[model samples]
Target: MVYSHSQVQLYKQCELRYAYKYIDRIPVPAEASLHLALGTSVHGALEFLYKEVQRLKVPSKESILEEYHSIRNEQITKIQEENKRSQLDQQQVADFAHMGVEYINWYYSTYHPFDQSIVMSTEEKVFPKLDDDIKFRWQIDRIDTQDDTFTIVDYKTSKRYPKDTDETFKDQINLYGRAIKQNYGSKFKKLIAKIVYLHLRNEIAREVTDEEMEKTRIKYSSIIQEIIKKTQRRSNGDKEAFKPVQWYRCDSCPFKMICPLFAHNYIHDEAVNLDDMKPTTIKAVIDEMAQMAYEIKRLKEQKDSYAKILGNYAAEKGYKRLYGNENKVIIGKSENYSPLPEKKNELESKLASENMLDDVVDIDRFKLTKKFKEHELDYDQYQDLVKKSVSITAQRPSKLKEKEIDEYMDIIGEE
Candidate 1:
């Protein structure tokens, strides 16, 4: 079995989305977002900077920006050529490209001369196998060493930097640190992690405790075991074991057009009969809809009727979430990120400095960071180089065939 943190997260997000991409291997027709395209460029530029530093050379800001723009242009062109219809428009593409320029320029300005740690390696891939049949694989963006200390620096290009307690990003870096110890026999006295938010032009550092490092290995192994069990169940004839997870983020999902939840995108023409579902279920569904209609009528609410009718149909059917032409149906509660006290204070201070505390429509962290930099020390020349960002999707995972699971188990001496 081959798995990674992202693969596990995908299973958590929606098993059905995982099934569509991995099990069915459907070709997703979604366009690449600006966040991802610019991130790709920033990562490459950082790698180039380290490689140059490793050779006892300093990379100028212009050269680094040049490399970033070059990579961004190449990536956008390749995305367009491959996805002629799905690729982003020229303005959208330019906006993303602009962000990469700012991110790289800021990154180079902050961390030149490589004083933080001795660069051990960049873009390193680690494969840690627990047994003959199971292996966990992931790539570390860059790993740096100082004396006996090992620091895994994960780069981010987001408008909002993650809190120190953000589980997803924190666990990912910790997983890398533990993997190094497990697979490479790295015995560093200090294990640290730094999330260098390129957008903010600052770094968040944490010393990884022994307890945290050890737990990462155990938790990661548990995730892998779970995936194996799920795959075994599927092979044993659990046809619908993998079902779609109904989350509101479906609008951004590449598989949304093909998801069965939407109904219209699914091309099946099979007829349904009342005889198939239990009489009780059919009656319950009708009764629920009838009750909702009555309530809507009694309340004299015209537009709210559809929500009752459609939402009940979704809830009563136990379908994950409801969505089609427009995702008007509400399946469950929703969530969004809220700034913690520290973030709020920091943002308020900056807003106060600019005398726009009340004029704040919605705080754009990217623009705010740029504004502070320009006010403190002018860099209007780099104004055109600024960029925007959102969260990026995970990369595809490695595949292992189900037919080989048994043989692989035998080779690993499993019963």
Candidate 2:
């Protein structure tokens, strides 16, 4: 049950995805987007450049940039090939490659390439758990010892930087800081955990406070417990509990077709002859429907109330007076109620006929807040339940007969 920050993030995204990727050993397709490949190439180049600087005390950024440029064409070609195979737009591939170059440039300019001394660049640093049962591991990007303090530097190519006030970033950085503390102990005078958002052209450095470390320790402990529970349930052959909770992000997920929610949606669409859906989206549609339902209910009530008031006003004015005659008292309902239903039915029928209704109607399977009673289960317990329910099912035995084996034995005949 080894877990890292990235694994934790994946689990939070979708337990079934984590199971597919890590537990079930499903192969994730190689990321072939220009942006993705360029990011990888840039990271590699930076690692190389920094390692050289660490060893030789100086490395030419211009030379590194030149080398990157030389391979840039090849990288673009590779990305284009991948895009062709994957059916990704060529424009997106080009955009991503350009962004990657920008990110590299950002990194070079921010660090002043040659000005900063590389204390430990691209080191394969690890943080092993203090407890033998908890085999938590983290490979930090770089550890730069500047002046009296040490900074754990992590490079990011994301366009947006996590705000300093963002809770998620706080948790992530704090966890990294805790890992550093747990591994290094008191070796460094001061430990600063920093995330360098290359694309955003900003850096965030947060000191490993005692409180933050404690929180990190508690968080990892809970994460480990959930992992153990998931493993236990997996070993016990509890398959039904492991159905994946379909989400909006599943659109980008490779296992969406295999996932129960997605599969169900796919089947419904095919059966009904529906239009092509976005494939991996579920939550957004559900949320939208929920909002629409709420709005519809609210609008109905509001319209009724408004109609009543208008009817009263018309009655007070006497229908003829309201209509500018001032003699006959005409009584009538303010507006028609049946029109709403007619419109709704018309839309529904059109969608059903076009087979687009299933895409709009398929609901999210995981309703955590609705299903679980408040304070009845903690966060870890809830996460464990999610993991337990999303375990990969075992394959059924084939019903077909076995093929006959042929043996080549001619020695006896020859004799």
Leading candidate by TM-score: 1
For all candidates in order, the CA lDDT equals 0.72, 0.64
Task: Give the alpha carbon lDDT tens digit for every residue of 1-415 in model 2.
Answer: 4567777777766877887787788887665556667766676667767777777655666766766666666776776665565565668766776676677777776675455644664755565462566655666677777766778887778777656575666766666676666766676778888787877788877787868767766776786677667756676885533447667787688887678754433332122222665544343444445677777878999978976776788778666334436544345654643325648878778889999978676444456544542223455756745543435542332222221001011211221
lDDT of 2 at 124: 57
RMSD of 1: 22.8
- TM-score list, all predictions: 0.63, 0.60
Ten contiguous residues with the weakest lDDT in model 2: 403-412
Instruction: Write candidate 1's Cα lDDT for 212-321 as tens digits.
Output: 86676677677666666666666788655577788977767788756766533233223435665644443345445667667766677755676677767877788767
Which residue runs does candidate 2 get wrong by more than 4 Å?
67-84, 87-90, 163-166, 268-415
